[model samples]
Target chain A: MRIAVDAMGGDYAPAQIVLGAVEAVRKYKCDIVLVGDEEKIKAELAKTGMANNPHLIIHHASEAIEMGEHPVEAIRHKKDASLVVATKLVKSGDCDGVLSAGSTGAATVAAKMFLKMIKGIDRPSIATPLPTTHGIALLLDSGAIVDSKPRDLTEMAMMGSIFSKYVYGIDNPKVGLLNIGEEETKGNKKVQATYPMLKQAKDVNFIGNIEGRDIPSGKADVVICDGFVGNIVLKFAEGLAVTLFQLIKDAIKNGGILAKLGAVLVMPALKKLGRRLDVSEYGGAPLLGVNGCCIICHGSSNAKAICSAIGVAIECVKNDVTGHIRDSIAEEELLANDSETI
Target chain B: MRIAVDAMGGDYAPAQIVLGAVEAVRKYKCDIVLVGDEEKIKAELAKTGMANNPHLIIHHASEAIEMGEHPVEAIRHKKDASLVVATKLVKSGDCDGVLSAGSTGAATVAAKMFLKMIKGIDRPSIATPLPTTHGIALLLDSGAIVDSKPRDLTEMAMMGSIFSKYVYGIDNPKVGLLNIGEEETKGNKKVQATYPMLKQAKDVNFIGNIEGRDIPSGKADVVICDGFVGNIVLKFAEGLAVTLFQLIKDAIKNGGILAKLGAVLVMPALKKLGRRLDVSEYGGAPLLGVNGCCIICHGSSNAKAICSAIGVAIECVKNDVTGHIRDSIAEEELLANDSETI
Candidate 1:
């Protein structure tokens, strides 16, 4: 299968993207199409020493979307932008999926505008992986569709459950509504309204409501919330992890001679722990519910992160997550009335 | 100042609460009134060896609210509950403030029902302390006032700012609206509606929007959001910190002999870092915008946490935070129109 990579997106564009594409070709045996400015992409690819490899292709686009550009405006105006062109390839079925370590907003916009949504899906969502004690739990609508209606949340539960089962290989994933309290009645208007709808869906294992503390405890395989709340939780966890690690480092370095020795002895273990909390280690979060799979990496992602993202893109295609979501939504639509869609 | 503390409240109950109350009396010279079943409070106080101190008093409370009880229902039915009695003490002007490690919902309901709202205050908000690199940042509406209106958010900003300036002694504390993006136009209906209201408030040092990542960075002194979002962020941070610390401990313990030795050596430094992130270290979050000071501690709080919460109670009374809020909100009401108040 072929995957189109946005070569000019992310903080470490071109170089890391090109290197990751080459590594993906060797590891996953999937053809990679580098879509970006040819001169720069070619220069970066040359450093990989596999620029002439038949598995690696360069379908250069003239324009590139900047990290700060307005998502919809960028997609509308930058017709030839790398992100738009890459998404267009997936839309045309020229590529099975697309990957980017770019502006998530831009990627989501382009994906919706070009690739569109799967049948019976009203909105697309970002299905992000959060590392838990038992393993990884999926948090969906992770900054894709904010101000969600009950129907929107039920859709998230469906898509998140499908992604967990297909991509993560979790059978009968337990879906929980993210709320302030674990009680079924506790939550804001959006969540409370969504609770009954989620429980109504027989396809998902609705485990009732789960609080923020429950996320790390692996109480549920999939926790769903509005994109606004989901994004806040995801980013806050990211920032808190960074601060705590920094605090630990400073403490270890400042502690007298004994602490310094301890730091040395425990370095390996600490590294392992860090890897467990690191976002890049888990690969990119997939923008689920779109017509084709689109994986979004953090903008500051390195080559390793990009490689993991490529792996994620391959898994999504191989697992047919989008297809499963389409089928599930279609079944839900057939069983429920038209008013239930809202 | 005299602070009434619910002696039978947290996980540790009367024993820790009595010990903490004794410590508070010694440190701040504030009179402590322990509200609970008379026999239980007396027994616990005797253990602290300060049972005979004239500054320590036991107010008999026949009932106690369980953590799992529905908040409003518990407040209504458990008239003789320890939490209700403590707040009633504040209401009757017999105590300067009230502190509890009881159900947050119970504390909030009691405070609102007994003490009432400060003049022109739309809703009472819980201003929680979050540990950050620069120190601690205050997150408001942190479980109180869920599903906030635009006016409710503006009130949180006002109250949080007053809290930072008076209690934390920060001058012109930077207040921010927590949203998905840094852009003014980049949030859901609630946040987007609240943005301009905060900006219009001439008294506030409105710094525009802050994303979740900015929270741990200490970029804003006061971050305001609806309790639904605020509570999630707070809980997520707490859970993540616990997980990371656990990971570190396990990493060190499971690592070979050298790592185990290193763990012992680094124990002191790790403890210091842990204290920095510990909820009890910063004391309880004040239930702001109330007619009287009300500090709410965690259910799992120990003696040290209780003592810190007592300290917070004394500070709120000394700072006259509620009085200041009354004045501020009165002024805000004069400026903003009606229908803004919920």
Candidate 2:
């Protein structure tokens, strides 16, 4: 399978991206099309001593989209941008999937503009996998569609459940509506309206409402919400984790000689805990409901994270997750039509 | 000042409440009115050896609201509920303020029913003080009004600023609208509408938009949002903190003999860090926009937390927080009238 990698994206840019692509080609045995400036990509690849590898192919693009530029405007004006080129490769059937760690808005807009949405899908969602006590919970619409309707949320639930089942290997994934309270009557107008619809959905294993406290405890496998709330929750969790870890480090640093000695002894176990909570190992979050599989990584992702993201791309292509989502949406529309006739 | 305590509220009930009231009497030199079942209150007070203390008084309440009951329904049916009676004491001028660790909904409902809203204020908010890297930031509308309008958010901003300046002692509190992005054009429909209003609000020190990550970093002293978002953020932070701490403990436990020994040496420093992040020491969150001061503690609060909440009640009464909110709302209304005429 051929996977297009946006070599110009992310904070580490061509260096880390090229290194990850090389490793992915060696590890996953999949063809990698490195899309970016030819000179910069070739230099990075030469440093890795894999410049002559047959599995790694260089697909040059002249323009690059910076992180701070407006997403739509950037994509519209920068025709030959690396991200745009990578997505075009997928649209032309030259590549099975694409990956980018660039601006989320840019990735989303380019995907919609080029690759387009799946049939019967109104809006696309970014499904983020969060590490929980039991396993991972897929939180969707994580900043994709800011103001989502109840219908949009239901679509997210269906897409999330499908993604979790096929990609994460959770059979009959439990879907939950993110609400203020666990009761059916609780939450804002949007959540309250979406709750009953989700409960009645045949495709979703609706487990009622799950609160913010339930998130860390892994109350549900699939958590659905509007992009606005999901984005805040995702960012807030990241911030809190960083803040708490920093606080712990500061405590050890300020403590006397004995505390420093204790820190040395506990370093191994703390590192283990950090790895367990690490997002890098879990690969990147996917923008669901799109025509092609597009994995978006964190901006600071290293070579390891990018390699994992490539693996995620391979998994999506092999499992035909996009095809399953399309089928599910079509089946739901059929069910609705039959009910209307009755 | 005399503060009425809901002696039958919270998980610990009359025992912890009475102990806290006794401690408040001794430490703050304030009078305490315990409102609950007279017999239960007396029994709890006797355990503290302060049954006959001159600073303590018992006010009988016939009913108690459970945590699971509907807040408004329970408040309506249980007229003599401990929380309702405590609020009545504040309304009748028999007590300076009231404090409860009962169901937040019950406390908010009872406060709204008994104390009523300040003139020109349509909705009340729950302003929760979160411990930040630098001091505290007051997050408002933290579960009071679930579906809030732009006008309600602006009111919350004004009230939060006033409360922070008077109670938290920030000379010029920076009020921020909690949104998904730092840009003025970002966020959901509600947040987008509220941005310009908060910017033009003369009473608030509007600092544009703040993302969820900005909250723990102390980007603003007063963070304003709708109750739906605020409640989720509050609960999520609490859950994440608990989860991370438990994970660290588990790591130490499973890290073998050397790790255990290290944990022993690091115990003191970790305890100090825990104390720094402790929410109980911050007193309790205040229910703003009411006619009287109403401090609401966490349901799992211990005797120390209850005592701190009593201190919060006294602080609000001494600082005339409710009066300031009332004056601010009236001033906003007057300004609106002046602008309309022009």
Candidate 3:
């Protein structure tokens, strides 16, 4: 299967993106189509001695979307931009899936405007794999839809469960709503209303509300919430991890000779721990409920992150996650006997 | 200032609570009144060898509120419970403040019922100190009001600013409305509506919208949001810190001989770092907008956390935070030309 890569998207664009595409093409037996400014992409590829890869192809574009630009407006104006063109390639069936490490809003706008949402899906949700003690929990709607109704949250649960089962190979993935407390009536009005809807969903193994403290312990396979709360939780987790690690590093450095020596001795193990907690190591967040498989990577992603993002794209394509979600939604509708339920 | 302690509250009950109260009285130079089963509290106090301190006093109470009991129900039924009695002391002007490390819900209910709200305040808020790159940031409504309006969030910002200045010694603390993005119209309806009110408020230094990722970096001195979002962010940060520290500890334990040696050498530094990130070190969250100072410590608080909670109470009393909030609200009303506004 072929995957389109936005080579001019992330902070380490062109260089890392090209290297990642070349590595994926060489290591994983998949065709890679790199999209970016032709001259820059070629120059970066030549510098890495990866210009001769037969499985790699260049899809050039003249414009790039800035991180600060309005997502919808930028996509509409920069039609030939790397992200927009890559999304169009997926929409036209030229590629199996698309991957980008750019502005999340821009990626969402492009994916929805070009590829569109799947049938029976009201909005596309972003689902990321959160590493927990029990294993990995799938957290959805990290920032896609800011305001959502109870029904929207239920849809996210169904979509997240299917995605985890198909892509992560977890059978009967348990779905949960993230809130202040585990009780049914413990959260805001939106969560209180959504609790019953999720409980009644047929396809998902609804396990009820999961608190934020339970997230790291992997209390549920799929932790669903509205985009506003989900995004804050996701970002808070990321920031806290980074802050703690930095504090550890600072403590070692500031503690004089003994601490510096200790830091050096355990540097390898600490490095491994850092790698495990790194966001880039987990690949990209999947934009679920869409017509095509799309992964949104971090804006500052490096070569490793882009490579893992490509791997995620390949996994989604191979597992047929989109089809599984469609089937799940259809099956749930049939069970509930309501076509407008979602 | 005399602070009433719920001597039978928290996981360790009279033992840790008594020790913490003794420490607070000695270290912070504050008079302590222990409220609980008088016999048990005196027995626990004997173990700490401070039973003879002239500053320590004991109030008789025959019952205690179990953590598992419903908060409102417990307060209604257990009239002479430790927490209830302690709250009553504050209500009757027998104590300057009350400290409890028991049921958060119970503490909230008792504080609201006994201490009452400051005039012109619709609802009270719980403000907790969150660790950030630039020291501590104040986050309000950290599980107090689940459902809130735009005006509530605006009031929280004003209260939070005044709190940071008085309690944390921050001058003109930059206040930010937590949202999905940094744009003018980035978040859900609540945030969108709250933005204008925050901007219009003359009592606070409004910094516009801040994303979740910026929290750990101490992007703002005060991060204002509804209780739902605030609660999630607080728990997420706590969980992530614990998870990361556990992972680090595990890595050091299983990383062979060199890693073990490194851990031993850096044990002191690591322990200090861990302590710095510990939530218990920050003491209890103060319920803002109450007529008197009320601190709500975590349920699992140990002796150290209990002591910190009492210190928070003393700080509030010294700063006259409640009186300041009352005056600020009055000034804001006069400036807005709306005497009926809350």
Tell me the native contact fraction for each prediction.
0.74, 0.60, 0.72
Interface RMSD of 1: 1.1
TM-score of each: 0.97, 0.98, 0.97
lDDT values for all models: 0.88, 0.91, 0.87
* lDDT minimum window of 10 residues, candidate 1 chain B: B333-342
lDDT tens digits, residue span B147-190, model 1: 88999888888889988998889999999899999888998988
Tens-digit lDDT track of model 2 for B162-271: 88988889988999898888998898889999998998887789999998888888889999988998999899888777777788899989999888899888878888
**In model 1, which residue pairs have backbone atoms overlapping below 3 Å?**
none
- Residue-level lDDT of model 3, residues B166-246, one tens digit each, is 988999999988888889878899899999888989789999999887888899999998898888888877676678678
Q: Where is model 1 chain A poorest over a 10-residue stretch in terms of lDDT?
A: A333-342
Output the number of the lDDT-best candidate.
Answer: 2
lDDT of 3: 0.87
In model 3, the clashing pairs are: none
Better of 1 and 3 by lDDT: 1
In the order shown, the candidates' DockQ scores are 0.75, 0.75, 0.73
Superposed model 1: Cα runs more than 4 Å off: A337-342, B335-342
What does candidate 3's lDDT look like per residue over A255-306, in tens digits? 8888888888888998887677676777899999888999999887888888
**Residue lDDT tens for model 1, A116-143:** 8887888888989999988999998799
The model with the greater DockQ, 2 or 3, is 2
In candidate 2, list every pair of residues with a backbone clash. none
